[model samples]
Target: MGPLTPDNYELVLGLICFFLIFGVLGKVLLPRIERLLAEREDVIVGGAARAEAAQAEAQRVYEEYRAELAAARQEAAQIRQTATEQGAAFLAEVRAEGQQQRDELVAAVKVQLAADRVIAEAELREDVVQLAVELASRIVGEPLGDLPRTRAVADEFFERADQAAGEVQGSGAHA
Candidate 1:
């Protein structure tokens, strides 16, 4: 017989021992291993589902945050626009009031100037009449002093001078 070959009795004993071991492993260990594999697969699937749900929730929150931020920006822009309009209105109101005050001051100054001019004209007329009377007395060599007649002559002279001045001013304006 060859060195590697077994005898008939040894072959039969080896076959019997191999079958006993295989049967014991199948009956005692296989079901427990299958149950552990199923439980591991379930945990993996459940973890994936939880991760997906969390990601969806995060996305929703991010979208909501973006919407809120946009709303806040729009509101701020509106506030700025309103403030600008109000400021413009207030500036216009202040400018209008200033213009009104300036116009009032101009009118008051014109009235005061007119009153001063009347008083100056009256004083000049009186002085001119006195001077004319003294000059007439010196030239005639007689004290013929008549105040009323002198004033009448002066008024006539002033009327002619005013009419001449008006004509000159009118011609200047046309030019």
Candidate 2:
């Protein structure tokens, strides 16, 4: 039967094997494992830092966008104000131009009316002279065919009548 106690050679062999395994784990396997763990931790921490930086950058961009939008709104208001002023000026100018045209039309109409009145007065005088000549000829029991003589006598009579009317009006005004 085998002894309960281990032999010296077997004990020495076990101790040597244990030391070899311990040395390999401490010098080679353990260092490699620790380096891998450190690398993993660095990756995790760096990823978190990058996420925070990206978030900050995004916030900055958002603020810049807001500022640009505000500026655009302000510029739009200014443009509207300028356009309103220009439109008002243009409207005023158009109104003034229309008024000038109206005044010119009124003046032209007045001048035309004066010319028509003069022409109508001359035609009325001719008709009145012809009718007077016909009536006189009928009263005298003769045809007064002398139109030139009748027209000269009628014009002289109207001139005296107009002078008398002017004198009356002048006297009334003095009174």
**In lDDT terms, which candidate is top?**
2
Range of the 10 consecutive residues with the lowest summed lDDT in candidate 1: 142-151
In model 2, the Cα lDDT at residue 112 comes to 100
Candidate 2 on 1-175: residue-level lDDT in tens? 2788898899899999999999999999999999999999888998889889999999999999999999999999999999999999999999999999999999999999999998998898888888888899999988885756876799898899889999999999999
What TM-score fits each model?
Answer: 0.61, 0.71
lDDT of 1: 0.89
For residues 1-175, could you state the per-residue lDDT of candidate 1 as single tens digits? 6869998888899988888888887887788888888889878997888899999999999999999999999999999999999999999999999999999999999999999999998898788877878889899987646656766787899899999999999999999
Cα error, residue 33 of model 2, in Å, equals: 3.2
Model 1 Cα displacement at 143 (Å)? 4.7
Residues forming the 10-long window of minimal summed lDDT in candidate 2:
143-152
Tell me the lDDT of candidate 2: 0.93
